[model samples]
Target: MSSAQVALLPGVQQFLDRQHGLFIDGAQQAAQSEKRLTVWDPATGKAIATTADANAADVDRAVMSAWRAFVSRSWAGRTPAERERILLRFADLVEQNGEELAQLETLEQGKSINISRAFEVGCTLNWMRYTAGLTTKISGRTLDVSIPFPPGARYQAWTKKEPVGVVAGIVPWNFPLMIGMWKVMPALAAGCSIVIKPSETTPLTLLRVAELAIEAGVPEGIFNVVTGSGTECGAALTSHPHVAKVSFTGSTATGKQIARVAADRLTRVTLELGGKNPAIVLKDADPAWVIEGLMTGSFLNQGQVCAASSRIYIEAPLFDTLVSGFEQAVKSLQVGPGMLETTQINPVVSQAHCAKVAAYLDEARKQNAELIAGNVGPDAQGFYIPPTLVINPDANLRLTREEVFGPVVNLVRVTDGEEALRLANDSDFGLTASVWTRDLTQALNYTDRLQAGTVWVNSHTLIDANLPFGGMKQSGTGRDFGPDWLNDWCETKSVCVRY
Candidate 1:
């Protein structure tokens, strides 16, 4: 694989020159205590920055700042058009700093610069612009009613969507910039204040986003970022009394814990958690197309994507052929540093995560799963895991049951479509799944039986800003994007009057 082309932009030094610490109440501030944590560049395993480690006291300050902003006239009392203008300006600012933001995201999160440019930065810009249009469209509904007490009196009732006050937006590290936008932009569009606690592994892009948001004329305390470990900062934010809601994106275990904490205040919560997604290949499907789809689905973003198709089910007739073709594709993928234009597969997020994946592979081997190809980690300073495929996986094994969250896939064969549906729905997770077939009826039938939130007929891992994205069952609860997402950030109030 080719080495990355590291051409730092002219303004990057200036951007990096700015304080790289917690942003509280619209300004860069030191941690409540003097403690700090190092941020690493996963591509090269180098320390990029040492950010302040916020504690409970810092969480108190940030949440209170956001609470004050939520109730202040400058934020909560602003007209929809006024809010729209700020959001539009924020969108423009994102575009202005698009390249720099994309570079920071790639350097910090271990995603390819190409993906950061195209998906992360591009989607965030689009989301801000889209939510700007939605701000003015948030209207109340009128209802006509009858009054029983007085014969001459008529009643009027209506419902309006109002911001739910201070929101704790706990974002995941997988797609930091874009997912942060998913949590913050919609709440801001609905006229709420937000306190973002980004994942410890990838917090730089979010802090930079908050900086740009303040620059775009968002009021002080309207948007804040506090970075620290999940146990310290994350738990505090969720349990804080002033936090009206918690928007979290991470693993199922953490989401459950957040849900429990939020229950104390009965605070609303939106959780986008883990997935052990599946992809089904029919007998008559073309080998070339199936191979391409499986390769992209199983290894995209080094398979760290939450909705990636990790568990593959193929019909018995074509099982061996599909596995063989997929092994070849995985073997030929270009794995290297993320900034390289020619690199297809980048390193995993960290050395610890690489070791975790290695342990999973070892477990699979002990359980007698057939390793198809590519178990070799790159011999370098980075956290690299070669794309690996295991065939005829044991249904009860950890690799098949739990989320591997790496560039690893397990292939299994089924007798027919019925067995395929049974095996696909057998797992505890049901986030996303795909079915590849030329027959439309078979596709529709299979989709109906698959237990997941989003079902792709012949594709995999394709997401749009306008579609509702989340999971069913143990995967997660609540949704992101689409029209329903506005409901996730706001609460509905009913008003009735008699005249």
Candidate 2:
């Protein structure tokens, strides 16, 4: 908390004062409604910028533009090598502006500037380059089907993967820049044009990135940004007839709403929804390593991560050791503004979000849950919440059952890894889960039984560029990385010819 605050770069200052507009068809314009939303810096809770709040009309324009581009093959028609070059150029531009984007994300999304740089911007740079690498890999297979429909006719048949069409991406406020790219990058790699609707609170970085796409030589309508509330623009974009697929990352409730709307049109959807993600510490795991891994997985970005391990199940014999370790680790976190170099826990994105986390804590206290650490009182400014560690939470408590999406972690004791796996798989949300063990067999045993996407052994929250990420069960559908992402973004067409 004593660390000095980092000075703002001039680019961040200019962006903070700018009045931004919706990006459609490679052009920026005021929203049709002319309504706007003020941007805020979470560290100071100050209004820093304003951006157009697109209404239904603006949604229509963006979608239609993307649809036209898709239909006309403006972006999709390009050769894979051409697409790869442009995407690589875009990645390079993002890398060059990394500092500006990281600061802007910290200002808008409320994570530490260091995290914004390392995880948000830095990881995004990697994903962008990886997705660009996937351009040539987006392909189909040659299949041989035996048939006797015509006695002496020979048949040549094959299958091809084609871009689905115009895509609609709705991103959440937490880690906006990174998650937005999760939706945008793959769709582009598969040659599908896209329109992104960033969360109202964290729209600035995406808006800036869209403009940079132009500098990277991406065509108009290939990458678009629309900023507005979910009810207005989000709903409009998802349900639009021209949209072939909608990729959404948010709460379970909102994801369901989008699925319902997309259902009417049979539109494909890739939803990364809510998670009560679990981290299991088996009896054989070292307490020291478990403590360090959980500290990063649960407290990074102040635990705004959807895949964050909020619900932790420790084997009974090792439970107290971990509880003590986590308590001390949580207490040691330097809670302050993210711009400060020494700040380990930053404020949540908004006052409303802070209050939401507060309500859960209040309810946990009422349910007789024990808080061993993270009750370091309020900061003088901003929407801050201490990194809270709760134990002995009531079985029925929402703190243990739901995704707090904040720096609140719940610890439960289990008899063994069996019990830990059982309890971990006991949630409706299974976006991610991790198991820690020295036994390779035990870890491999979990691969088939964890019932979640992206299970990790000995680590958690480590998202790799080559691995596929997404939830199973209600954690949501579809994958987000590597070749699995391309599968979701494209449709396969089987062609047969008689020669």
Candidate 3:
């Protein structure tokens, strides 16, 4: 790579040198344990900074603070319109600071700066605005009661949607700002105070956002962040007595552990876990379009996306042609640091993740899975893996069965759309899947049978704030985004009276 290819944004180093702390109550605080974790830049395999590592005590303090804020109703007590204005202002702050946040995100998480700006900061701004709009729209209903009572007696009943109290928002490493917003915005929009636990690997953007929230006039303690590991901080948040609901986005295994902890407390929980999402290319789909969708679907975020099109099935007629195009696209991607404007494949988040992704390639070799495209090892110093593709792997093989969570995808030849659906629905995970076809009838038919939470036609990995997004089966539980999320963050209370 040349100097121009590795060029970084100015001031990235300055931003990293600043000390970061856990955001609790309305301020930044050192963890009671006085421990910290080193934030790494996977793009260069370098340590960026150390962040305060909170433990159980810190979690308890933050949760209590959130609970206090909720009960005091400083934020919850505000009129919907008032809350809306405040959050909209927060969105403005996010937009104003977009470049800074995007830089931090790219450096901390090793995703392309373009993505960090367009998807992370830009999408989060949209999410905050959308959730702000929801504040005014969150409502309950008046119900007509059927009562067998004395003549002329009248009874009426209505329901009030109440916030679920203090919320524990556990976000994952990928798309830290967006997922953090997804977890916290809805809870706050529903008038619930929240304590956010960002993945230790990527905490910079969330911490900054919390500060911006305060500046935007969100009441102190309405949003808090406790940075630490899953064992100490996350476990504490899950079981905190003040935490009425737990919203998490991470691995299926971790989600299960959190679910068990939440279950013990009977806490309301919403989980968005892992996915081995499938993208099917039907025979009738345009070659050029399907090829574009396949490349974007599989390689976006270096395939770190939970709902990435990691597993692809193509009808036999189009498999060879589509795979050839995909291979060319994969080969053309420029792999380098995120700050490089031309870099298409940025480094994976960490060395450990890169190794984990490599193990799948080793397994593929052992199973004689045809290597369609990719480099098994990093060509550069950072935790990088070239976009990888595999073909002809056995249906039950680990390569096809597991979530690689890297820049790797599997291509399988199917007889037709029906066979494609059968193979696509075979996974235990069903977070998302996409079908490319011009046949509306076949697309709808496959859409009805594709066992995933969000299915796309002629597109992949596209999401919006107005839509509900979640997983089915082992992929995880409950919905996020849109009105349904507001309901999930709230409890419906029925009131009836007789006159």
- Residue 493 miss distance in model 1 (angstroms): 1.5
Choose the strongest candidate by TM-score.
2
List pairs with backbone clashes in candidate 3. Answer: none
Clashes of 2: 0
Write candidate 2's Cα lDDT for 299-349 as tens digits: 889899888889889999899888888988888888877888777888899
| Model 2, runs deviating above 4 Å | 1-3, 375-379
How far residue 297's Cα lies from its native spot in candidate 2, in Å, is 1.1
Report every candidate's CA lDDT. 0.86, 0.88, 0.88
Report how far residue 254 has shifted in candidate 3, in Å.
1.2
RMSD of every candidate to native, in Å, equals 1.8, 1.6, 1.9
How do the predictions measure up, each by TM-score? 0.96, 0.97, 0.96
Error of 1 at 427 (Å): 1.2
lDDT of 1 by residue, 362-439 (tens): 998898888866644446558888788888888778898899999989888989878888889988888999998989
